[model samples]
Target: MTSRSAPDRLLSVLAAFDHAHPALTLTDISRRAGLTLTTAHRLVGELARWGALERDASGTYHVGLRLWELAALAPRGPALRQVALPYLEDLYEATHENVQLAVRDGGEVVYTEWLSGRSSVGVHIRVGARWPLHATGVGLALLAHGDPGFQEEYCAGPLASFTPYTITEPELLRRTLAEVRRSGVAVSDRQVTPDALSVAAPVRGPDGTVTAAVSVVVPHSGARVPALTPALRLAARGISRALGWHPPTPVPAEDT
Candidate 1:
Protein backbone atom coordinates (compact mmCIF):
# COMPACT_ATOMS: atom_id res chain seq x y z
CA MET A 1 0.00 0.00 0.00
CA THR A 2 2.73 2.41 0.86
CA SER A 3 4.52 1.80 -2.43
CA ARG A 4 1.41 2.19 -4.59
CA SER A 5 0.69 5.54 -6.26
CA ALA A 6 -1.33 8.14 -4.33
CA PRO A 7 -4.36 7.95 -6.63
CA ASP A 8 -4.52 4.15 -6.47
CA ARG A 9 -4.34 4.21 -2.66
CA LEU A 10 -7.12 6.81 -2.38
CA LEU A 11 -9.33 5.01 -4.89
CA SER A 12 -8.85 1.79 -2.94
CA VAL A 13 -10.45 3.39 0.11
CA LEU A 14 -13.45 4.57 -1.89
CA ALA A 15 -13.78 1.25 -3.69
CA ALA A 16 -14.23 -0.50 -0.35
CA PHE A 17 -17.77 0.80 -0.22
CA ASP A 18 -20.33 -0.79 -2.52
CA HIS A 19 -23.99 -1.85 -2.69
CA ALA A 20 -23.20 -4.86 -0.51
CA HIS A 21 -21.10 -2.93 1.99
CA PRO A 22 -22.25 0.66 2.05
CA ALA A 23 -20.97 1.43 5.54
CA LEU A 24 -17.60 0.51 6.96
CA THR A 25 -15.78 1.23 10.18
CA LEU A 26 -12.21 2.52 10.09
CA THR A 27 -10.84 -0.95 10.77
CA ASP A 28 -13.05 -2.49 8.11
CA ILE A 29 -11.90 0.10 5.58
CA SER A 30 -8.28 -0.53 6.48
CA ARG A 31 -8.58 -4.29 6.02
CA ARG A 32 -10.74 -4.06 2.91
CA ALA A 33 -8.48 -1.43 1.35
CA GLY A 34 -5.32 -3.36 2.26
CA LEU A 35 -3.89 -0.33 3.94
CA THR A 36 -2.34 0.12 7.35
CA LEU A 37 -4.46 1.60 10.11
CA THR A 38 -2.59 4.89 10.06
CA THR A 39 -2.75 5.11 6.28
CA ALA A 40 -6.48 4.36 6.33
CA HIS A 41 -7.09 7.00 8.94
CA ARG A 42 -5.17 9.64 7.04
CA LEU A 43 -6.88 8.82 3.76
CA VAL A 44 -10.34 8.57 5.32
CA GLY A 45 -9.88 11.92 7.02
CA GLU A 46 -8.77 13.47 3.77
CA LEU A 47 -11.71 11.99 1.90
CA ALA A 48 -14.23 13.09 4.51
CA ARG A 49 -12.74 16.57 4.47
CA TRP A 50 -13.11 16.64 0.70
CA GLY A 51 -16.78 15.61 1.05
CA ALA A 52 -16.21 12.32 -0.76
CA LEU A 53 -17.09 10.39 2.41
CA GLU A 54 -19.01 11.05 5.60
CA ARG A 55 -18.36 9.91 9.16
CA ASP A 56 -21.42 9.22 11.23
CA ALA A 57 -21.92 9.61 14.96
CA SER A 58 -21.00 5.96 15.37
CA GLY A 59 -17.83 6.58 13.31
CA THR A 60 -18.90 4.43 10.37
CA TYR A 61 -18.00 5.87 6.99
CA HIS A 62 -20.47 6.10 4.07
CA VAL A 63 -20.38 7.37 0.53
CA GLY A 64 -21.24 11.07 0.65
CA LEU A 65 -23.66 13.17 -1.40
CA ARG A 66 -20.76 14.85 -3.14
CA LEU A 67 -20.13 11.62 -5.01
CA TRP A 68 -23.71 11.65 -6.23
CA GLU A 69 -23.26 15.22 -7.42
CA LEU A 70 -20.27 14.12 -9.43
CA ALA A 71 -21.92 10.91 -10.65
CA ALA A 72 -24.77 13.03 -12.01
CA LEU A 73 -22.35 14.44 -14.54
CA ALA A 74 -21.78 11.06 -16.14
CA PRO A 75 -23.38 10.90 -19.58
CA ARG A 76 -24.61 7.35 -19.11
CA GLY A 77 -25.87 7.90 -15.59
CA PRO A 78 -28.02 10.87 -14.61
CA ALA A 79 -27.98 12.45 -18.07
CA LEU A 80 -29.61 9.33 -19.55
CA ARG A 81 -31.93 8.98 -16.57
CA GLN A 82 -33.09 12.57 -16.86
CA VAL A 83 -34.30 11.95 -20.40
CA ALA A 84 -35.61 8.45 -19.70
CA LEU A 85 -37.54 9.13 -16.48
CA PRO A 86 -40.75 10.36 -18.07
CA TYR A 87 -40.93 7.38 -20.41
CA LEU A 88 -40.07 5.05 -17.56
CA GLU A 89 -42.82 6.66 -15.53
CA ASP A 90 -45.23 6.11 -18.37
CA LEU A 91 -44.28 2.47 -18.59
CA TYR A 92 -44.70 2.18 -14.84
CA GLU A 93 -48.15 3.73 -15.13
CA ALA A 94 -49.14 1.34 -17.89
CA THR A 95 -48.39 -1.83 -15.96
CA HIS A 96 -47.85 -0.61 -12.41
CA GLU A 97 -44.85 -2.89 -12.43
CA ASN A 98 -41.12 -2.54 -11.95
CA VAL A 99 -39.43 -0.39 -14.61
CA GLN A 100 -35.70 -0.09 -15.02
CA LEU A 101 -33.08 1.73 -17.11
CA ALA A 102 -29.50 0.53 -17.25
CA VAL A 103 -26.22 0.95 -19.11
CA ARG A 104 -23.52 -1.61 -19.77
CA ASP A 105 -20.22 -1.44 -17.92
CA GLY A 106 -17.93 -4.07 -19.35
CA GLY A 107 -19.41 -7.48 -18.48
CA GLU A 108 -22.13 -6.11 -16.24
CA VAL A 109 -25.19 -3.91 -16.54
CA VAL A 110 -25.42 -1.10 -14.01
CA TYR A 111 -28.92 0.08 -13.25
CA THR A 112 -29.22 3.86 -13.37
CA GLU A 113 -32.93 4.20 -12.55
CA TRP A 114 -35.76 2.02 -11.22
CA LEU A 115 -39.45 2.64 -10.69
CA SER A 116 -41.74 0.34 -8.76
CA GLY A 117 -45.30 0.69 -7.60
CA ARG A 118 -46.35 -0.20 -4.09
CA SER A 119 -47.64 -3.54 -5.31
CA SER A 120 -44.97 -4.21 -7.89
CA VAL A 121 -43.47 -7.66 -7.95
CA GLY A 122 -40.44 -8.14 -5.74
CA VAL A 123 -37.15 -8.22 -7.64
CA HIS A 124 -33.51 -8.46 -6.68
CA ILE A 125 -32.80 -5.05 -8.07
CA ARG A 126 -32.10 -1.48 -7.01
CA VAL A 127 -30.56 1.65 -8.42
CA GLY A 128 -26.80 1.14 -8.91
CA ALA A 129 -27.23 -2.61 -8.73
CA ARG A 130 -25.25 -4.75 -11.18
CA TRP A 131 -25.72 -8.15 -12.81
CA PRO A 132 -23.82 -10.11 -15.41
CA LEU A 133 -24.62 -9.56 -19.11
CA HIS A 134 -26.42 -12.89 -19.63
CA ALA A 135 -28.74 -12.94 -16.62
CA THR A 136 -31.18 -10.09 -16.93
CA GLY A 137 -33.27 -8.43 -19.63
CA VAL A 138 -31.39 -5.15 -19.67
CA GLY A 139 -28.13 -7.03 -19.58
CA LEU A 140 -29.09 -9.22 -22.54
CA ALA A 141 -30.38 -6.23 -24.50
CA LEU A 142 -27.12 -4.37 -23.96
CA LEU A 143 -25.01 -7.43 -24.67
CA ALA A 144 -26.85 -8.29 -27.86
CA HIS A 145 -26.27 -4.79 -29.17
CA GLY A 146 -22.65 -4.61 -28.09
CA ASP A 147 -19.63 -5.30 -30.28
CA PRO A 148 -20.09 -8.62 -32.07
CA GLY A 149 -16.65 -9.93 -31.19
CA PHE A 150 -17.11 -9.09 -27.54
CA GLN A 151 -20.50 -10.77 -27.53
CA GLU A 152 -19.00 -13.97 -28.92
CA GLU A 153 -16.21 -13.82 -26.35
CA TYR A 154 -18.67 -13.25 -23.53
CA CYS A 155 -20.77 -16.20 -24.68
CA ALA A 156 -17.72 -18.43 -24.74
CA GLY A 157 -17.01 -17.57 -21.10
CA PRO A 158 -18.75 -19.19 -18.16
CA LEU A 159 -22.20 -17.88 -17.29
CA ALA A 160 -23.46 -17.59 -13.75
CA SER A 161 -26.73 -19.36 -13.07
CA PHE A 162 -29.21 -17.96 -10.62
CA THR A 163 -32.05 -20.30 -11.51
CA PRO A 164 -32.73 -23.38 -13.62
CA TYR A 165 -33.83 -21.25 -16.55
CA THR A 166 -30.71 -19.11 -16.74
CA ILE A 167 -28.91 -19.79 -20.04
CA THR A 168 -25.58 -21.40 -19.24
CA GLU A 169 -24.84 -22.96 -22.65
CA PRO A 170 -22.72 -20.76 -24.91
CA GLU A 171 -24.40 -21.94 -28.12
CA LEU A 172 -27.84 -21.22 -26.68
CA LEU A 173 -26.67 -17.81 -25.59
CA ARG A 174 -25.43 -17.11 -29.11
CA ARG A 175 -28.81 -18.07 -30.51
CA THR A 176 -30.49 -15.84 -27.90
CA LEU A 177 -28.45 -12.85 -28.97
CA ALA A 178 -29.40 -13.47 -32.58
CA GLU A 179 -33.07 -13.52 -31.62
CA VAL A 180 -32.69 -10.31 -29.62
CA ARG A 181 -31.21 -8.55 -32.60
CA ARG A 182 -33.87 -9.93 -34.91
CA SER A 183 -36.81 -8.95 -32.70
CA GLY A 184 -35.43 -5.70 -31.27
CA VAL A 185 -36.29 -6.92 -27.77
CA ALA A 186 -35.09 -9.42 -25.21
CA VAL A 187 -37.02 -11.52 -22.76
CA SER A 188 -35.38 -13.00 -19.71
CA ASP A 189 -37.79 -15.47 -18.21
CA ARG A 190 -37.05 -16.76 -14.74
CA GLN A 191 -33.36 -16.13 -15.32
CA VAL A 192 -32.39 -13.99 -12.38
CA THR A 193 -35.00 -15.47 -10.08
CA PRO A 194 -37.48 -18.32 -10.24
CA ASP A 195 -40.52 -16.08 -10.34
CA ALA A 196 -39.58 -12.92 -12.19
CA LEU A 197 -39.82 -12.19 -15.90
CA SER A 198 -38.16 -9.25 -17.60
CA VAL A 199 -38.74 -7.81 -21.08
CA ALA A 200 -36.25 -5.24 -22.33
CA ALA A 201 -35.57 -3.07 -25.37
CA PRO A 202 -32.45 -1.24 -26.40
CA VAL A 203 -32.01 2.52 -26.26
CA ARG A 204 -29.89 4.28 -28.84
CA GLY A 205 -27.75 7.39 -28.76
CA PRO A 206 -27.33 10.03 -31.46
CA ASP A 207 -24.97 7.83 -33.45
CA GLY A 208 -27.57 5.02 -33.47
CA THR A 209 -25.40 2.96 -31.22
CA VAL A 210 -26.96 0.92 -28.46
CA THR A 211 -26.19 3.10 -25.46
CA ALA A 212 -28.62 1.87 -22.80
CA ALA A 213 -31.73 -0.28 -22.20
CA VAL A 214 -35.19 -0.08 -20.64
CA SER A 215 -37.04 -2.97 -18.99
CA VAL A 216 -40.14 -3.97 -17.07
CA VAL A 217 -40.04 -6.81 -14.57
CA VAL A 218 -43.12 -8.70 -13.53
CA PRO A 219 -44.13 -11.94 -11.85
CA HIS A 220 -43.36 -14.91 -14.05
CA SER A 221 -46.54 -16.79 -13.18
CA GLY A 222 -48.81 -14.65 -15.33
CA ALA A 223 -46.34 -12.61 -17.34
CA ARG A 224 -47.86 -11.44 -20.61
CA VAL A 225 -44.93 -10.82 -22.93
CA PRO A 226 -47.21 -9.82 -25.78
CA ALA A 227 -48.94 -7.19 -23.63
CA LEU A 228 -45.74 -5.84 -22.14
CA THR A 229 -43.68 -5.67 -25.35
CA PRO A 230 -45.37 -2.64 -26.85
CA ALA A 231 -45.21 -0.48 -23.74
CA LEU A 232 -41.62 -1.45 -23.05
CA ARG A 233 -40.62 -0.71 -26.63
CA LEU A 234 -42.40 2.64 -26.44
CA ALA A 235 -40.45 3.67 -23.37
CA ALA A 236 -37.19 2.57 -24.96
CA ARG A 237 -38.00 4.41 -28.15
CA GLY A 238 -38.92 7.61 -26.30
CA ILE A 239 -35.65 7.56 -24.43
CA SER A 240 -33.74 6.88 -27.64
CA ARG A 241 -35.45 9.82 -29.32
CA ALA A 242 -34.69 12.06 -26.38
CA LEU A 243 -31.06 10.98 -26.68
CA GLY A 244 -31.21 12.19 -30.33
CA TRP A 245 -31.29 8.83 -32.11
CA HIS A 246 -32.89 8.69 -35.54
CA PRO A 247 -33.61 5.31 -37.08
CA PRO A 248 -31.76 4.79 -40.34
CA THR A 249 -33.74 5.41 -43.51
CA PRO A 250 -34.12 2.36 -45.71
CA VAL A 251 -32.24 2.37 -48.98
CA PRO A 252 -34.28 2.31 -52.21
CA ALA A 253 -34.83 -1.15 -53.67
CA GLU A 254 -33.05 -1.71 -57.00
CA ASP A 255 -34.96 -2.88 -60.10
CA THR A 256 -33.97 -6.28 -61.46
Candidate 2:
Protein backbone atom coordinates (compact mmCIF):
# COMPACT_ATOMS: atom_id res chain seq x y z
CA MET A 1 0.00 0.00 0.00
CA THR A 2 1.26 3.46 -0.87
CA SER A 3 1.57 5.78 2.10
CA ARG A 4 0.03 9.24 2.02
CA SER A 5 2.34 12.27 1.97
CA ALA A 6 2.71 14.53 5.00
CA PRO A 7 0.59 17.37 3.52
CA ASP A 8 -2.15 14.93 2.55
CA ARG A 9 -2.16 13.41 6.00
CA LEU A 10 -2.38 16.81 7.66
CA LEU A 11 -5.13 18.06 5.36
CA SER A 12 -7.09 14.89 5.91
CA VAL A 13 -7.10 15.53 9.61
CA LEU A 14 -8.39 19.09 9.02
CA ALA A 15 -11.01 17.92 6.53
CA ALA A 16 -12.76 15.95 9.25
CA PHE A 17 -14.34 19.15 10.54
CA ASP A 18 -17.33 20.52 8.65
CA HIS A 19 -20.48 22.45 9.41
CA ALA A 20 -22.12 19.21 10.58
CA HIS A 21 -19.20 17.92 12.62
CA PRO A 22 -17.52 20.95 14.16
CA ALA A 23 -16.22 19.14 17.19
CA LEU A 24 -14.61 15.70 17.46
CA THR A 25 -12.68 13.50 19.87
CA LEU A 26 -9.33 11.88 19.10
CA THR A 27 -10.96 8.58 18.17
CA ASP A 28 -13.47 10.33 15.92
CA ILE A 29 -10.70 12.18 14.13
CA SER A 30 -8.69 9.00 13.77
CA ARG A 31 -11.66 7.21 12.19
CA ARG A 32 -12.84 10.07 10.02
CA ALA A 33 -9.34 10.97 8.74
CA GLY A 34 -8.60 7.36 7.92
CA LEU A 35 -5.59 7.35 10.22
CA THR A 36 -4.51 5.03 12.98
CA LEU A 37 -4.85 6.21 16.59
CA THR A 38 -1.12 6.89 16.98
CA THR A 39 -0.89 8.87 13.74
CA ALA A 40 -4.05 10.82 14.53
CA HIS A 41 -2.78 11.67 17.98
CA ARG A 42 0.56 12.89 16.64
CA LEU A 43 -1.02 15.07 13.92
CA VAL A 44 -3.76 16.36 16.22
CA GLY A 45 -1.16 17.43 18.73
CA GLU A 46 0.80 19.27 16.04
CA LEU A 47 -2.33 21.02 14.71
CA ALA A 48 -3.54 22.03 18.17
CA ARG A 49 -0.13 23.44 19.06
CA TRP A 50 -0.03 25.32 15.75
CA GLY A 51 -3.50 26.77 16.54
CA ALA A 52 -5.34 24.95 13.72
CA LEU A 53 -7.44 23.05 16.28
CA GLU A 54 -8.36 23.60 19.90
CA ARG A 55 -9.35 21.12 22.57
CA ASP A 56 -11.90 21.92 25.23
CA ALA A 57 -12.17 20.65 28.79
CA SER A 58 -14.06 17.57 27.56
CA GLY A 59 -11.19 16.76 25.15
CA THR A 60 -13.28 17.54 22.07
CA TYR A 61 -11.39 19.51 19.44
CA HIS A 62 -12.91 22.37 17.45
CA VAL A 63 -11.47 24.54 14.71
CA GLY A 64 -9.17 27.06 16.31
CA LEU A 65 -9.02 30.85 15.90
CA ARG A 66 -5.70 30.53 14.07
CA LEU A 67 -7.43 28.77 11.18
CA TRP A 68 -10.04 31.52 11.16
CA GLU A 69 -7.26 34.09 11.04
CA LEU A 70 -5.85 32.38 7.98
CA ALA A 71 -9.25 31.87 6.39
CA ALA A 72 -9.77 35.63 6.58
CA LEU A 73 -6.94 36.02 4.07
CA ALA A 74 -8.85 34.12 1.41
CA PRO A 75 -9.97 36.63 -1.22
CA ARG A 76 -13.34 34.99 -1.88
CA GLY A 77 -14.32 34.32 1.73
CA PRO A 78 -13.78 37.06 4.29
CA ALA A 79 -12.40 39.61 1.85
CA LEU A 80 -15.50 39.38 -0.34
CA ARG A 81 -17.68 39.38 2.75
CA GLN A 82 -16.09 42.59 3.98
CA VAL A 83 -16.83 44.34 0.70
CA ALA A 84 -20.38 42.93 0.33
CA LEU A 85 -21.57 43.25 3.91
CA PRO A 86 -22.88 46.82 3.59
CA TYR A 87 -24.99 46.01 0.57
CA LEU A 88 -26.26 42.86 2.24
CA GLU A 89 -27.13 44.87 5.31
CA ASP A 90 -28.94 47.41 3.21
CA LEU A 91 -30.97 44.77 1.42
CA TYR A 92 -31.86 43.12 4.70
CA GLU A 93 -32.91 46.44 6.22
CA ALA A 94 -35.02 47.33 3.19
CA THR A 95 -36.83 44.02 2.80
CA HIS A 96 -36.57 42.58 6.31
CA GLU A 97 -35.90 39.21 4.69
CA ASN A 98 -32.98 36.81 4.77
CA VAL A 99 -30.11 38.24 2.74
CA GLN A 100 -27.12 36.27 1.51
CA LEU A 101 -23.88 36.62 -0.44
CA ALA A 102 -22.38 33.59 -2.15
CA VAL A 103 -19.79 32.52 -4.69
CA ARG A 104 -19.56 29.42 -6.84
CA ASP A 105 -17.07 26.76 -5.80
CA GLY A 106 -17.10 23.75 -8.11
CA GLY A 107 -20.76 22.69 -8.59
CA GLU A 108 -21.97 24.25 -5.36
CA VAL A 109 -22.48 27.80 -4.10
CA VAL A 110 -20.73 28.68 -0.84
CA TYR A 111 -22.54 31.33 1.14
CA THR A 112 -20.16 34.06 2.43
CA GLU A 113 -22.57 36.28 4.32
CA TRP A 114 -26.09 35.88 5.72
CA LEU A 115 -28.34 38.36 7.50
CA SER A 116 -31.95 38.01 8.58
CA GLY A 117 -34.34 39.69 10.95
CA ARG A 118 -35.86 38.10 14.01
CA SER A 119 -39.27 37.81 12.27
CA SER A 120 -38.03 36.69 8.86
CA VAL A 121 -38.87 33.27 7.51
CA GLY A 122 -36.47 30.59 8.74
CA VAL A 123 -34.11 28.93 6.28
CA HIS A 124 -31.45 26.23 6.45
CA ILE A 125 -28.71 28.68 5.45
CA ARG A 126 -25.74 29.93 7.43
CA VAL A 127 -22.48 31.78 6.68
CA GLY A 128 -20.75 28.76 5.22
CA ALA A 129 -23.65 26.62 4.03
CA ARG A 130 -23.47 25.08 0.55
CA TRP A 131 -26.28 24.53 -1.96
CA PRO A 132 -26.54 23.09 -5.44
CA LEU A 133 -26.36 25.53 -8.36
CA HIS A 134 -29.77 24.78 -9.87
CA ALA A 135 -31.78 24.80 -6.63
CA THR A 136 -31.12 28.29 -5.25
CA GLY A 137 -31.37 31.81 -6.65
CA VAL A 138 -27.78 32.81 -5.87
CA GLY A 139 -26.60 29.50 -7.24
CA LEU A 140 -28.58 30.10 -10.43
CA ALA A 141 -27.13 33.57 -10.86
CA LEU A 142 -23.57 32.24 -10.45
CA LEU A 143 -24.16 29.20 -12.64
CA ALA A 144 -25.79 31.27 -15.35
CA HIS A 145 -22.73 33.49 -15.53
CA GLY A 146 -20.26 30.62 -15.28
CA ASP A 147 -18.19 29.38 -18.19
CA PRO A 148 -20.50 27.89 -20.83
CA GLY A 149 -18.60 24.61 -21.05
CA PHE A 150 -18.60 24.08 -17.28
CA GLN A 151 -22.24 25.08 -17.12
CA GLU A 152 -23.18 22.48 -19.70
CA GLU A 153 -21.23 19.79 -17.85
CA TYR A 154 -22.88 20.72 -14.54
CA CYS A 155 -26.35 20.78 -16.07
CA ALA A 156 -25.83 17.34 -17.59
CA GLY A 157 -24.82 15.84 -14.24
CA PRO A 158 -27.18 14.50 -11.61
CA LEU A 159 -29.35 17.24 -10.13
CA ALA A 160 -30.33 16.67 -6.53
CA SER A 161 -33.93 17.46 -5.55
CA PHE A 162 -34.70 19.09 -2.27
CA THR A 163 -38.22 19.96 -3.32
CA PRO A 164 -40.46 19.05 -6.25
CA TYR A 165 -39.75 22.43 -7.78
CA THR A 166 -35.98 21.97 -8.21
CA ILE A 167 -34.74 22.08 -11.79
CA THR A 168 -33.73 18.51 -12.49
CA GLU A 169 -33.74 18.44 -16.28
CA PRO A 170 -30.64 19.61 -18.09
CA GLU A 171 -32.59 21.31 -20.88
CA LEU A 172 -34.83 23.08 -18.38
CA LEU A 173 -31.84 24.13 -16.32
CA ARG A 174 -30.17 25.46 -19.47
CA ARG A 175 -33.32 27.42 -20.26
CA THR A 176 -33.47 28.80 -16.70
CA LEU A 177 -29.83 29.90 -16.87
CA ALA A 178 -30.48 31.65 -20.16
CA GLU A 179 -33.41 33.53 -18.64
CA VAL A 180 -31.31 34.50 -15.61
CA ARG A 181 -28.62 35.84 -17.94
CA ARG A 182 -31.14 37.78 -19.99
CA SER A 183 -33.01 39.28 -17.06
CA GLY A 184 -29.95 39.87 -14.83
CA VAL A 185 -31.92 38.41 -11.92
CA ALA A 186 -32.76 34.87 -10.84
CA VAL A 187 -35.93 34.03 -8.93
CA SER A 188 -36.12 30.71 -7.07
CA ASP A 189 -39.63 29.92 -5.95
CA ARG A 190 -39.93 26.98 -3.58
CA GLN A 191 -36.87 25.37 -5.10
CA VAL A 192 -34.77 24.97 -1.97
CA THR A 193 -37.74 24.48 0.30
CA PRO A 194 -41.50 24.21 -0.13
CA ASP A 195 -42.35 27.42 1.69
CA ALA A 196 -39.41 29.70 0.82
CA LEU A 197 -38.50 31.76 -2.25
CA SER A 198 -35.31 33.67 -3.12
CA VAL A 199 -34.45 36.45 -5.58
CA ALA A 200 -30.78 36.79 -6.55
CA ALA A 201 -28.59 38.98 -8.75
CA PRO A 202 -24.96 38.54 -9.70
CA VAL A 203 -22.14 40.65 -8.26
CA ARG A 204 -19.28 41.34 -10.57
CA GLY A 205 -15.57 41.97 -10.12
CA PRO A 206 -13.51 44.81 -11.60
CA ASP A 207 -13.40 43.16 -15.03
CA GLY A 208 -17.19 42.73 -15.17
CA THR A 209 -16.97 38.96 -14.64
CA VAL A 210 -19.61 37.63 -12.29
CA THR A 211 -17.76 36.96 -9.06
CA ALA A 212 -20.51 36.44 -6.49
CA ALA A 213 -24.27 36.74 -5.93
CA VAL A 214 -26.59 38.55 -3.53
CA SER A 215 -30.09 37.42 -2.63
CA VAL A 216 -33.05 37.83 -0.35
CA VAL A 217 -35.09 34.86 0.77
CA VAL A 218 -38.68 35.28 1.87
CA PRO A 219 -41.74 33.15 2.48
CA HIS A 220 -43.24 31.72 -0.69
CA SER A 221 -46.88 32.37 0.16
CA GLY A 222 -46.75 36.13 -0.47
CA ALA A 223 -43.44 36.46 -2.33
CA ARG A 224 -43.39 39.68 -4.31
CA VAL A 225 -40.90 38.95 -7.08
CA PRO A 226 -41.98 41.91 -9.12
CA ALA A 227 -41.45 44.29 -6.24
CA LEU A 228 -38.29 42.64 -4.99
CA THR A 229 -36.49 42.48 -8.31
CA PRO A 230 -35.72 46.19 -8.50
CA ALA A 231 -34.29 46.40 -4.96
CA LEU A 232 -32.31 43.24 -5.40
CA ARG A 233 -30.82 44.48 -8.65
CA LEU A 234 -29.82 47.77 -7.07
CA ALA A 235 -28.12 46.03 -4.18
CA ALA A 236 -26.20 43.79 -6.53
CA ARG A 237 -25.10 46.77 -8.55
CA GLY A 238 -23.93 48.57 -5.45
CA ILE A 239 -21.84 45.60 -4.41
CA SER A 240 -20.34 45.28 -7.89
CA ARG A 241 -19.47 48.94 -7.91
CA ALA A 242 -17.75 48.62 -4.55
CA LEU A 243 -15.78 45.73 -5.96
CA GLY A 244 -14.46 48.07 -8.75
CA TRP A 245 -16.72 46.99 -11.59
CA HIS A 246 -17.60 49.82 -13.93
CA PRO A 247 -20.99 48.93 -15.38
CA PRO A 248 -21.09 49.13 -19.16
CA THR A 249 -23.09 51.90 -20.81
CA PRO A 250 -24.93 49.95 -23.54
CA VAL A 251 -26.01 47.44 -20.91
CA PRO A 252 -28.21 48.59 -18.05
CA ALA A 253 -26.33 49.79 -14.97
CA GLU A 254 -28.23 47.33 -12.84
CA ASP A 255 -26.80 44.33 -14.68
CA THR A 256 -23.31 44.90 -13.23
lDDT on C-alpha atoms for all candidate structures: 0.91, 0.93
The TM-scores, one per candidate, come to 0.94, 0.95
Q: Give me the overall lDDT of model 1.
A: 0.91
| Model 1 worst lDDT run, 10 consecutive residues | 247-256
Candidate 2 has its poorest 10 consecutive residues by lDDT at 247-256
Query: Which residue pairs come into collision in candidate 1?
Result: none
Candidate 2 residue pairs in clash (backbone atoms < 3 Å): none
- Estimate, for each residue in 49-111, the C-alpha lDDT of model 1 and write its tens digit: 989999999999999989879989998888889999889988988899999999999999999
Model 2 regions lying over 4 Å from their true place: 253-256
Tell me the alpha-carbon RMSD of every candidate. 3.1, 1.7
Indicate which candidate wins on TM-score. 2
lDDT (Cα, 0-100) at 183 in candidate 2: 91
